[model samples]
Target: MTETSPASALLEVTDLAVGFRTMDGQVQAVRNAGFSLGAGQTLAIVGESGSGKSTTAMAVIGLLPGNGKVTAGSIRFDGQELVGLAESKMRAIRGRSIGLVPQDPMSNLNPVTKIGTQVAETLLVHGMATSKDVDRKVVEVLTAAGLPDAAERAKQYPHEFSGGMRQRALIAIGLACRPRLLIADEPTSALDVTVQRTILDQIGRMTDELGTSVLLITHDLGLAAERAAELVVMHRGEVVETGPARQLLEDPQHPYTQSLVRAAPSVAAVRLSPGAFAAPASQRLHLAETEPGSGGAGPGGSAVAVATAAGPDGVPPEPAEQNYAKTPNIVELKDLSKVYRIRGKAGDFHAVRNVSLEIPRGRTVAIVGESGSGKTTTARMLLKLITPTSGSITFDGVDVASLEKKALRSFRQRVQPIFQDPYSSLDPMFTIERILEEPLKTYKRGDRAERAARVRELMEQVALPASMLRRYPAELSGGQRQRVAIARALALNPELIVCDEPVSALDVLVQAQILKLLGDLQRDLGLSYLFISHDLAVVRLISDYVCVMKDGELVEAATSEEVFQNPRHPYTRKLLASIPGNELNIDGELAS
Candidate 1:
């Protein structure tokens, strides 16, 4: 990578270290991490879940909670050491000299407040402008970030905006003061593929136009390779490799990087035949095995790799890259709808309208929508988590909503639900070993010894260590806890798993790893997943079929490529257009 412009270097992180003191052990989340970004430059810190990318970003902003501490480091923003600065003093620098685009908008944004007020508050805090001026600046920032009708939008609360727009609002606040440096931690993790692309591209362009430097923390190597000029690869809180993005992706120096690229799954070999979606999961898993030159890590952390010995799709190949590695009918909905009645003085509310669709087995179908858009409600109906108000919810030809308690529990074994937050899904009081084994015990599938063995196998399947089994959920990072959650979901060996925004909380790199794992599992075990997420980009990468929802209604559903390349639904199109990555114009918005 070229040198950060000596005079233009806006933020420099030198010899940074971060750790967490817990009862079980002291986890070194980051150690001796260093990087520099000049005006208009974007630097991406890429790594798997435990690599400490998020920890480093948190340290830069003095935001580590609990027992986590910045053991040693210098976060130099415009040559000012921010590590030891007082809260009030540091507060001045933040949003003015340095800004933050938080990972989770839900947590970062106040639910009850208007979006405009939040953005205005930032300006007010820095005393950059008067109330009137803050309002005008808020509108300008929102417009630049590509939100629709900035004036009207600013008045709406966080709950009103779509997932993509909410992200843009966060950026607006971060850039409200035109800070010299922007720290974005997994900014695109929860967005759809199209949205993910748009968000990054927008950031890329905005940084250039504003001459703002950026420190991007993500796990998505593909994204890092595409957007970042320089790449820093970390593993276990240590920097193992740092270099140009293209070089690292094309010819990674570290074994971990190399293995990650190999283990990733691709969309090129998606079932093209009439019976493609109907093929046994085993056959689909082995579909591309015999045809490839060299085998990489197979899906779901399973060791099996199969190929057909065919050429590369009879087309000139781009390159052998991307490490690692969905459907229509099993979960079908006809006139599916959900509504809730207000018990107080108010009346009934229609949360979900009439929706209809057929989900094929062995294919992934994503239900994307804003919060309260009936996406979660739909998932509940499918998994029988919550009975639909008035719709025929069929799973494997059975009307699940009509089932009794015992039968419903039995049906749950066939279709399990994976939650969005790793923090809440796991029982903090329960050991990881116990957490994983609970599902198996609930089902009484086998002997205690056999169940214990299954837990171990599952731990290996999710790429988690057996030793982690002794630890509690609080003892693990966001990614590890999520992995354990997946293992728990897999214990029943269900025919279908309802994954609800599973990777939204993880860093991009860890998100990719989880996506790769899900793909691997589908191939190895031929498991059918009913994946639900707001992230269209991940949906694009992993799903066979796409289902877009808005306000509890179906917007669109089609193949991955078809939907991404040409989205007919206006809402879906808006989501695609708002992605930050696609908004990137490498003309040096900052350099100019």
Candidate 2:
């Protein structure tokens, strides 16, 4: 096992500052930041959106963008100065000694390349093995990641794997030759709770077994608490505080850390000291359990039920027929399904199967499922993004499919969709001012002066700086960009916003801010939402109703309180079991 060398640190970054030249002005993207890592150690840098955590990591890897440059800093890796290392020299050590597992493996991986070939390239490039050894090494590394049918899966491309599996495949590539350090950024943000545990557990176990120092950069404090030994808090391009994970989280010396830890809304209270709140085993389990029948509990009170398909004449039907509800329904569907046709070879694939559900307005609904399970598809149909293959979506006493092109625009204006990656949603060429004004312009909501004034009002509404009006999307942090996205969604004063994993990309504290922002908005505006996400903890906090989806089918839809407390569907039970908490314990379906 690799051990920390007292002679010198494995990776040391000192006095780092990064800046970028923008049309408006020179923005200080990253301020003075410093940290170090040793073998078998895990350090997590936590902060809200716009903090310099990601910038620091990129500087260390020499991956800074074109306009951004390190003003002052030094990076020493294993006694070798890396600040000015040649690309060729750095490339040799990048994966061999300092590996990187990116934020979105789906985007990072080559879509057309086979998984085994991708795994073997790392070894071949580093000169660790020959072409003949690729197949065996691929199987070995993939199996180590707990992937089933390793040999067969190895031959598939990245598109063939689920979000969690793709994450493991990337980890397998990172660990192919066992680098001294591994950088994983928001590794599990995109996966469901059940699959989330498997990925986190695998990464933790591998990092421990290989003695590879891990730098886990993320916004989720719970994830850090689960895997990291040490924590560093950064804000506005500076290191605010640093200490052991338990110490910094429990009794955080910095106000920022305290605010972040409090933001989760998980009802977890943090005490300021080591081993602060030690609950008995029974208490832990009880806290995980919430008030029962959580229907219509989200944002407004989410709606959930495990009712199956209904037969003709309002009679109770098969599992694939209908999901009945005792109360009046806000949103109802019958046999909703979506299918996508492959370009040339394999025919069509059922992206979402027959789904039937009923959700009350002013209630939050969570659709849970693995990747490609049609969670997003359901959200899209609700938003009228694409015409459903064969189903009806009735909203506010009107059939959505009945609308024409001109009418669809009006529907889009009312039912806005907030995406997962806030940065991509906004245009890079436009300033925040222009970005917000375009929608108002398209809809002709207000005059120029009214639009400009509304833009400033929106910035403050989402808790952003007034100075951010002229700034571009790239200038803002992930959290800030999300706030901007929210502002855009509200430009028309939308009634029901289709939030598609809006908070998944942000840090825990920023997540709290966004949730509070949404909740406050709903209370004040009386807005309804169809929230689609995989984070159960966040779902519990914001949703009143829950809808669980699988293989394109609605497995369970019920109140958040009921679904979390007394889940009837087997899939719902599995999802609750996967959350990263000690309170509620449900055994995973995977055989022990």
Candidate 3:
């Protein structure tokens, strides 16, 4: 490795190794990881979960959990070695010199504390300001972080803030001290595209203005490519590739990097082959040949097959044509609106507004928007969890609003839900078999032996080992938990599935698996989906038609292709543009 001068680099990590002492044994988390961030420069470490990206960052900041420790390597900051630093000394440098914007705002921020108090506490602890100037400083930082009504917002508790607002508050605290270096770990991974862009842009402006170096750790290759000057790709605890961001992405020298580029839904121009992320070579080749213009030869050895496919065959069919092609709508919403009247608030809060949509048989209609866009509220209304103030919802020409208790229960069996956080969604006390069988038993789908057999069948359908049926939720990985959730949703063989941010919590590779599973199941079982998500990229991969929501209203609606390729609404266009790594072409070529 070439030596980087101390004067030029703000933080330099060399041959870093980290490990966790589990009950089984010492598990190495990071092995031989190295990177350098120059003053005022941005460096990003990109990888899937357990690739040691976050572990490396935490080691650099001396914030590893109890079981974790830096087993080897050197972390040098501003010519000072951090590996052997005393806890007292490390604490002094932590917030004062190196700040952090953690991944989850809800977990990072104290629920009991006011936003202003939280910001002020950081400043006071670091001795950055006196009590007299702390309030003013807090307001200034909050405003700088792009929070509206900074002073009033600061007084509100964390629960009062929206997801975006809470993130802004976290940013305010991170930048309040104007630290020389900032470590942002998956900061916008959970956010909607527009809000993510806003927060990241704000961070960029603040860091640039303050001349602070940034170390960004994320699973989003596009985000890293767009935001960072340098990129380090990690896999299985090792740095497999590191170089200039654009060059590395455009022409990755490593196999893992290549797979990541191909698997990332944001970079894919079309819906992927089922299990394409993990497909065998022959399978990939078959899919490529079958897909028009995937280097498939046509008459006269011309690529004309590709060009022809781009027209009538490839373009999204017109709505009228679509209605003609598919079966009659399985579910329909007409002039749907939901309003909540707050006791003290002057005006009623409109949670959903005159939104009209349709879910045709065996099709997926995705609702895309930022948090608070009424996507969940709209789904809840459809599920009859809450009553809609006006308009109507119909399933097979029967009004769902008028369904009685028994009929409603029957309707629920036909339309099931899969929640966002799989860990929380599944009952921890139950084994996987019991979890899957409970839904079957509750609906009286079968007797004891039949239900047990059905549980085994469900496990097979989700591609999980039957042996895992005896395991509890806590014993399984995030992906496995989600598979269990999928099995439970499929227990009744629901025709319509309401999937709400189903894969958001899993790692990228696991996310690909779950998405492929969903796509495959849809094809085989003829399932209809009302999918809701903030990730436009994932939406691109899964949905047939897309509804773009903003401020509880539908701002744009079209086929996925139309919405992605030629969005008429400015908000839709902005959301598309804001997708991380959307700037990077799939082949690592320059953006169009």
Model 3 error, position 499 (Å): 1.8
Residue-level lDDT tens digits of model 1 in 1-592: 6977535567788899898998789878888988788778889998777778888888888788879988887888777888878999987776777789987787789999999899888888888779767778888878877676799888888887766678778978887777778888887766656546656777777777888788888766556767889998888898888888777666777898776555332322233212232222222221121112221111111111222222236542223421112223576676676778743426676676767655566656667765556777777777766667886878888787678888888788878778988887899899999998888887887998998899999999999989998999988989898899899888898888889899877765576678878877887777777778766556656676666777677666555655666677688888776543332222211111
Error of 2 at 419 (Å): 0.9
Error of 1 at 452 (Å): 5.6
lDDT of 3 by residue, 469-578 (tens): 99999888778999999999999989999998998766667887899899999878988889999987788777766788787777666556667777877888888877
TM-score of each: 0.74, 0.79, 0.87
Q: Could you tell me how far off, in angstroms, the CA of residue 62 lies in candidate 2 after the best superposition?
A: 3.5
List candidate 2 stretches off by more than 4 Å: 1-5, 12-36, 66-74, 105-120, 133-172, 267-328, 342-348, 446-460, 465-467, 581-592
lDDT of each candidate versus the true structure:
0.71, 0.72, 0.80
Residues 1-592, model 2: lDDT tens digits = 2323545577787788888888887888777787778867888887876788887887777788888888877888888888878989988788888888777776788999998889888878887778887778789888876677799888888987866688778878877778888887777777777666876787677678887888888887767766788888998889999887766666777777767766654522211111112222211110011124442322222223433322336554433422223324556665677888854437886776666666555545567676666888888888877778887787777788898888878887878888888867899999999988989999897888998899888888888888988899987877888999999999988778889889887777778678878877876776677788888777766765667877677666655655766787787788767666434111111111
Q: Deviation in angstroms for 500 in model 1?
A: 2.1
Better of 1 and 3 by TM-score: 3
Q: Is candidate 1 or candidate 2 better by lDDT?
A: 2
RMSD each, Å: 9.6, 8.6, 8.2
The regions of model 1 sitting more than 4 angstroms off are 18-29, 64-73, 86-88, 110-117, 129-169, 260-329, 338-354, 366-377, 385-391, 437-466, 504-526, 533-544, 548-592
